[model samples]
Target: MINLAARDILHGWGKFLFTGIGLGLLIGTTLTMAGVFRGMVDDAQVLIDNSGADLWVVQQGTLGPYAEPSSIRDDVWRGIAGLPGVAETGNAAYLTIQMAHAGRESRVMIVGMDVDRPGRPGAPGYLTAGRPILHGHYEAIADERTGLQLGERVRLRRHEYTVVGLTRRMVSSSGDPMIFVSLKDAQEIQFLKDNDALVNERARTAANPAFNRPGVPGLLEAAQASSGQSRNVNAVLVRLEPGANPDAVAGEIQRWKRLTAYTREQMEDILVAKLIATSAKQIGMFLIILAVVTAAIIAFIIYTMTMAKLREIAVLKLIGAQNRTIAMMILQQALSLGLLGFLVGRASAGLWGPAFPKYVLLLPGDAIGGFMVVMVISALASVVAIRAALAIDPAEAIGG
Candidate 1:
């Protein structure tokens, strides 16, 4: 018996190949969408893991630094430091801002970390080039993705910082490159005001009767000085003693210190479930829609291919070709198309994943999962065309 599937593909290979390529591009996009979600989750986990913190202490009842704006006094870590099971504590300030570098503006997460220790909670896990920040003021460490070279100066607010170190995979949950600066500088940048604004504020305060009373000699100057300084940090990163439970330590901080404490698990939940939840759901919806579209396209192609072989199909039926044979022919064609599409998709996603601005982590397991999904969808979609072909009677072959 002739190989009907092979014959059909060979006879109309152009249409079949082009249709497969189109479907492949769609499938590629679908796979990329899934990869985008995976990349987001990976980035969140990496952000948490790289922090090397057992717990995060934020302002009371608020998600800090990532999900929302959280400000706690820089000294709050002192209280948390004295808590039991706390191995070490660090004050980390995270502020997302647009900074100008080489005449282009890029949004970066400015992470303020203590430079005295190399293994501090918020320090970079590893460096791609150069070393960690050693000096306190005017020095910076940037992720490689920022495209800033060592010794490059980037201006943040009114201050400029020299890029002293470089790191890899150091990113915010949104995949923005993280730039490390000293806590003091971060605080200043966070609250830095323009000279005109400062002058106007001083004038306004000096005019206030309560602050400008004759008995208050230096009250106005003192007030202005205090206003010029920032003593706040976004969140405190805490490391628990080995063998100590993070949840328990977090509870002590919350109860005694009157601050919100989150364990590693809790922080992950907040980042994934709350921070990027809507985006994940949106991608999921797009994946579903794309899958449906891919299936429809495959079904249409297979149906059209089968229809072109109407005379052959009718003759095969007339010559005692079993219904199973016809069905298998359609099924195999569908599967082949799906296989072709998947190959093209995987290649396309691989080629384009790195070009994306955000992290597009394409894992082997995810690729395997995508392949299975494509096969299943192709099989299901073939049902429509299979039914249509099976319904055609062999008598149609002999019709006028």
Candidate 2:
């Protein structure tokens, strides 16, 4: 028997090929949506991994610093460091803000770590360029995504910092690039008030009779000076000893220290499951809508093609073509169009993935699943055209 599907497609190859390309662009957008979701997940995972902490110790009754605003006294790490199975503890302060650099503003997460002591939990895992922050006050190590080069100065609140080092893939759960500064600077930036506010605070403290009683001049000065500094940190990053159980250590910190401690796994759950849950749902809804639209387009295109060839279909019916054979031919054409679209979409996604501002991770598993979904949609969409072709009268060929 002659291949009816191939013959029909060859006869109108221009329309078929262009229609496939148009459908392919839509498929590419769908793939890109999936990639955006995947990138968010990867960004969250990278944040957890790059922290290099076995446990995160934050204020009691709160999630970690990334998910919530957690403030604990900087000295809390000293107590946590002495706990059993605690090899080392580092105080960390986190603040997300818009940072200005070289005539542009970028959203960045400023991390304050003990840069004086290398290999601390909160420090950048590695630097791709220059050197780490050695100075306590103004030196910074920034993720390359922030577009900061070596010796470039960026202001954070009250002080300017020189970008001494650059790192890769160091971002917050929200995909904001990270800038590492000294613990003291981070504390001041996150907790301290501006100069005018500081003056007003000092006057307010001085006006209070509690500190300004007769013959208590020194006492009032002490109160004013202490109120001007910030000794608070967002969280304490803890590294456990070899073979230490993270859960046990976290429990001890929660019980004795009266603070919230999260093990690595639990923290991952908070960041991935809780932090990005809404975004994931939005992406899922988009995928469903795109699938429906794709199915609709396939059905419309195939139905129109079938209608345009009613005379040919009638001729085939008059020439002893089985209904099963006619149905198979339509199905084949739908599948072929879908196959072409999928190939073009996959290639387009790869070519344009990096052009996106945020990360777009196109996984092979997603691609495979997408291919299967497209084929199924194509098969289902052919039903409308198949029914129309089958309902035609064979006598229409002779009359027309």
Candidate 3:
């Protein structure tokens, strides 16, 4: 017996090929969605890796920077540095804002670091181009995604910043490009109030009899001066001494300083499990919907193909073809379509992955799993077509 499925496919290759391409495009979109979720998880991991800190210290009773608002005095790091098992500590502030560069605005995560020294907890591990911040103020190192070039000027509130260095892959957990600036600048930008708010606050303070008390020399002036400066930071990043236990160091800080300390593992859990939990759920729902739609499409295509071959199937039955032969032919055709579509989908995903704004990490394991799912869906979808083919009566071929 001739191989009927191959002959049928070759005879109607034009329409079959077009249908396969359309299905492949849908599969490609599904694969890309999976990559997007993987990319989000990877971005969180990268943010953790690049911080180069073993512990994070934040305001007491708070989840810390990414999960919620956390504010502690910048000077807390000084006390933390002297704690046992602590080798080095840095005051870091994190705030996300839309920044303008060369007429385009992009969202960026501003990181305040102690550029005064190398190998500090929050400093970028390395620079791809130019040099790290050399000035005590008004200089920055930006992630390349910000479209900033060395010496380019970027404005933050009333001050202007010059991009001094560019770093690669230093992004926030949400994939926002990071701009690393001096601790002072970040404090001023994030903590300081605007001029209008400041004037009102000063006026309010002066009117209060508490700060403007009679016989209290210089009381009003001191109160006004303190309100103008920013002394708070989002968190303190800590690097432990070699062989130092992270939990032990964290415990020491929590015990004496009355602040919250998180080990690297704890912070990672907050970022991936809590901070992005909603986003992960939304992506997972999309994956399920896409999978169901793909199965439906395969069933429709295979059933339609079987219906169109009813006359030929009747002729085969009249010539003594077994039911098993007919069912296998349909199953083979369905699997062939699935294989063709998967190869196209994989190629399409690879081609368009980099063009996405956020990272798109296509892991090999996901592809393998997807292929297995596709084959299973194909086999299941062929059942409908096989049932229709097996029901055709041989007498239909010899009807009057």
RMSD of each: 1.2, 1.6, 1.5
lDDT of each: 0.89, 0.92, 0.91
TM-score of each: 0.97, 0.95, 0.96
Superposed model 1: Cα runs more than 4 Å off: none
Model 1 has a clash total of: 0
Candidate 2: where is the Cα deviation over 4 Å? none
Query: Model 3, 1-400: lDDT tens per residue?
Result: 7887888889999988988888888888889999999999999989989999999999999998777899999889999989888989888899999998778888999999987788899999889999988888999999999999988989977788999999999999999999999999998888788889999999999999999999999999999989889788889999998999999888888999999999989998999998888999999999999999999999999999999999999999999999988998999889988887888888899999889988999999999999999889989999999999999999999998
Q: Write the per-residue lDDT of candidate 2 for residues 1-400, one digit (tens) a residue.
A: 8888899999999999999999998999999999999999999999989999999999999996989889899899989999999998888999999988778888999999997689989999999999978778899999999999988888988898888999999998888899999999988888788889988998999899999999766999999889888788989999999999999999999999999999988998999899999999999999999999999999999999999989999999999999999999999999999998999899898889888877899999999999999999999999999999999999999994
Question: What are the clash counts of all predictions, listed in order?
Answer: 0, 0, 0
TM-score (C-alpha, index-matched) for candidate 1: 0.97
Residue-level error in angstroms, candidate 3, position 270: 0.8
Better of 1 and 3 by lDDT: 3
